[model samples]
Target: MPDTAGLAVRTLTPDAPAEAPPVLLVHGFGSDGAGDWIDTGVAAALTAAGRTVIIPDLRGHGASPAPESAAEATAPALAADLLAAADAAGAATFDIAGYSLGARVAWAVAAAAPDRVERSVLGGLSPVEPFTAVDIEALHRAVREGAQCPDPFTAAIAGMVSAHGDRAPGLALCVEGLRDTPFAGGAWDAKVLPVFVVGENDELTRGIDGLAGSLGARLVTVPGAHHEVLGGPHFRDTVLDVLAR
Candidate 1:
């Protein structure tokens, strides 16, 4: 275990090489790598395929220390931390996969250093940025008013964030940090091997195909909604297929 710019990271190496590049798994907002990857069986599957797995608890989540300043919580900054995790894992170049918010950071990583990414799977992502219009102040008010907020999802997340105790404010700053972090069609141009996976019923489906085409990446549609997509067999199979290629 080591720190990547204040982020906590864990690496799981396979007993044998399946000829696959080491893989990095980045989790979504409010969630950590273990909760998103390991608990979902993604990490185990990758290891079963003989690929080493690098899982980092992004700053402000899990065991990682939260960023006291919004500047330290930007997506690009998080992307840089991923590279640090790669260095810790002794991987100069590696395969990568990320879900939701992590996918945004992954795009930044590949955009900044395409040569270091052998292949990348962007899951639960779309061309439209999700946090751009999120009303952080309203969400904060809802949290303070209790869990009986108007948006159930927001309330649930507020609960999770607040459960971390004093880390809530930092998490709020993180939300603000990512608010303007663009994943718009032209914001990132990654030439690395990239793919997109989304739930067929996901609202995030808009512009995903176009974004994938722009990157010359394949788009895989799996059954289920946004959060449920990662648990589907289609997602698992698609990830393995892409990595195998």
Candidate 2:
């Protein structure tokens, strides 16, 4: 559906009334709402079980609009785009699940407007102390050059997950976010949420566990590398587990 970001959102909803509330699946950078995660069967299985699913292409990724100015690519800005989608699509409220960069943006969205989101699952990232100029410059560089990892260590970490097709756009968006956080100006006091999923083998995601725990969120560890879990069979069940409640 059309939204503030002019982004296309993919959805899977049952023809019959759904048993669970809608769940929005946000894929990491370089991937679209569908290719990044929904196509993995996560969204489909949930909808099959009588749940409504919403998947959005964050701005600058996939079919979503890419901002000319750097300011438009931050997580907070992306969150605003989501709100526009919610309004344009007439969504009263819904659960959100974000993976990697999308997960970070989901955090901003739910944190900024807790009531607007029924429940939230941030799949790949943890909250960090406020960003610095170095972070901003790094984001700018990464956004401009899609594959530049700061160090061999980070590069190796990323290379392991690069086999997944959606990583490209994710890298680009990460650059943008690092250069300037969409929610930099806003403060989100991570409210309570039902659950958070982290990849057992992913060090990056493990860091996010600390963030989830601080929010008093439930944690479920899925087996596999970061990208694998996003594309894994159990992902759908883990995602729906939050809504199954």
Candidate 3:
């Protein structure tokens, strides 16, 4: 099939424009469009500040389609979704930002199609967290066996992610993507001067810093846990600084 990147895209169009262009937000793995940022109030915050915003549920995460194979879910494929979504959102060109897994996809998109994007804020990822070969055989076994655990977070520390997915047909697309993309953790083809944000004390922070240093980018520490950083004032201030630059 054609490059799977950018094939899946969703938008949250705004009614007003701020001094700057609209901001597209991409959520991390295991979350959807609304709960990802809309429910978190990030979308509303920027909108209130007069910045038009667009949020997408990156592949294997939300409304976007999950490719049947990891090859289809590669960073290139998911970046394609940003393009399609931006076009659909009526943003001929735009600034973009993403969190965690979403941040990775954003990097992929910016790397693959820099001309289409102006600036980007990548939150919660570091280059040190290199993507490794997956134990797909074991992962598939867990899925087929209907596994459940109260302390899955412990395992997630090693990227052993698990979630109760939707029965809706759309979820299958995302799930398939999760199964396919082993997150071969490294910067792909990208040269954008991205604004990277991470939580202080986050194990992932150093990794993100490493990535930024390699790319001639800068880093911002938001002083919170990984998931909650997006909600705090630091989140907005950091983003505004990036956009202002």
Candidate 4:
């Protein structure tokens, strides 16, 4: 484990000659690197295939320290942290694989360091910002007071945050930070076209087709819901195949 600034990163070295550029695996909201990538064997599989794998526990998630304010936890700030992690790994350029909120962060990373990102696989990403629709005040109230969130969407998000136990407050702050810097897919300017992967049953990414087309990116529909997609062999194989190309 190497600490880059405040981020705790887990690096996996390949057993043989490196077949591809270093890959950064960004995890989703309410979940850390281990829970999303490591536990599902994606990290090990990538390593076995001769790729150096870099996994960062994003700020306020896993071993990384929580941000004191929403400003500090913004997507751009997280993107900067990831670039620093790549720098620490000595990777001048790399590939990226991110899921859900991680996908949004990956978009930020690609935009910030367009020249450094060789390719990207964005999973479960929505055409519009998901958090912009969330009721932030209600979310905070739920986290702080154990009150029920009024909106069904906010309630669902609240449930996910609650699953993390004591980290609910920090996660709530992260959501606020993300909501502050919402995703606008059409505004993306990165030259490197990404491969967008979504589950057929994932309502979150329902309108991603339009965005993907505008970006001239490829879209691959996999076989599960948003949460189940990452852990499935379809996702792993799709990512592996894409990166190998």
Candidate 5:
């Protein structure tokens, strides 16, 4: 596919006639499109069901170029990149399934371009922005100076970032950008109704019920933790069923 907005997209064509609008699968933080969806068989399942799948490596992740500054990695910016990917894929409107940080970006996209999104499945998401509580200085120190984070949450995030190896700096910038534009589910005014899915054991999504109620949407809880849910068959099946409707 053509490179628009500097995002590297993996487009999968179905074996049979297309059964639905192009499905965009957005991966979570520190994970690329292939790692989150392709390797997990989510994209394959959707494609086998005759849906054109578009997976984009968000800025600062995978093969996509990292953002020069945190400003370039904001939700709106990432949403714009996804839109550009859709345009390149020849999809005027599409269904979206996003996990974790990707879910937040899906929210921004639906809010900004409601007419372009046919439906959305937000997995591993919450009304509360986890980045807001992140200690930015401590995170930066941990990434740059190999210092330990004092805060438990920050330490957790630092560990996730470190797992990405040299991508730690870019991911850290993304964290800062996300913190700057914290998610407020009450403020969401998208016309499209989204199905919210959270892992039953996910403490990070404590306020998901309130967020789903505010949107007049259904919340489906699967058996797993935050990261585990994304790779589970339950989460994949839930997304496929929701988008099929």
Candidate 6:
């Protein structure tokens, strides 16, 4: 079923035991749940653990509609979309986890419906909002005008958008929509079952301990960089152990 925002979603279940607290997995910017979770073996691991996983391709990515308007990509809007996915899956309560942009959005979800989210794992994210300093214009220039942009990071982001095929323009719009919105520590409710996970070498690691202190969550650091952390055993084990406990 399509969400209120008409985003595409999928629910994968293990064959042996179909009844388990559902786990909703959200992907990072310019990436879908399948690519970020399924292909990475995270989803498979969850399913093997008898978890029913609901994966939504956030708006402007994967099978979801790429809205031309940037406003459709706001964190609150994406958060609601995840809730809608839960509703569609008939999940009154579920565990949620996300990485990068997805982690930011998951924080929004926990804030929006503290009662619904049983536990959450925020991975590859930091206390400080990652995209606050990003230059959307420079990203657009690199992809649209083929201009020589100074920031390699921004340029690489633009390249990722372009590699996403037809969603390029929409992804760019989403990036612009997310520009003014940074992850606010206040959005993390202390009552929520939240865990903060990040790569040991990730630049985002700064101030994470402070944020975790505020959220009353344990901060777990694994060995790897921001992107590589997701594919490693430590990160995956940390999440699974949290959920298992």
lDDT per residue as tens, model 5, 1-245: 37579989999999894657999999998989999999999999998889999999999999998888889888998899999999999998899999999999999888788888887899999778889999999998999988999999999999999888888999999999999988888655555689999999998889899878876799999999997999899999998899884
TM-score of every model?
0.87, 0.78, 0.78, 0.94, 0.94, 0.90
lDDT of 2 by residue, 17-55 (tens): 564557777777656787866668787777777877777
lDDT comparison, 1 vs 3, better candidate? 1
Instruction: Give stretches of model 1 more than 4 Å off.
Output: 1-3, 140-166, 187-191
Model 6: per-residue Cα lDDT over 35-137, one tens digit each: 8998889988988888989999999999998866767777887898889989988898999889998998998888788888887899977677656666888
Report the CA-based lDDT of candidate 6 relative to the real structure.
Answer: 0.82
Candidate 4, pairs of clashing residues: none
| Tens digit of per-residue lDDT, candidate 1, span 1-245 | 54467678888988877866799999988889888999888888999889999999988888888887777788888888889888888888889899988888888888777878888888998677666665667656655555355665566656766776677777777777777575655644444657889998899767788877876677888899998988778888888888874
Report the alpha-carbon TM-score of model 5 versus the true structure.
0.94
Q: Could you tell me which 10 consecutive residues in candidate 2 have the lowest summed lDDT?
A: 129-138
Going through the candidates in the order shown, the clash numbers are 0, 7, 16, 0, 0, 0
- Give the root-mean-square deviation of each candidate in angstroms: 2.8, 4.5, 4.7, 1.6, 1.5, 2.2
TM-score of 3: 0.78
Candidate 3 lDDT tens digits, 118-187? 8788888756433333344444444545443234432242233445444222333343454455444455
Candidate 3 segments exceeding 4 Å error: 1-10, 13-15, 129-133, 147-162, 166-192
Model 6 residue 172 lDDT? 83
Clashes of 4: 0
How far is 55's C-alpha from truth in model 2 (Å)?
1.4
The whole-model C-alpha lDDT of candidate 2 against the native structure comes to: 0.65
Candidate rank order under lDDT = 5, 4, 6, 1, 2, 3
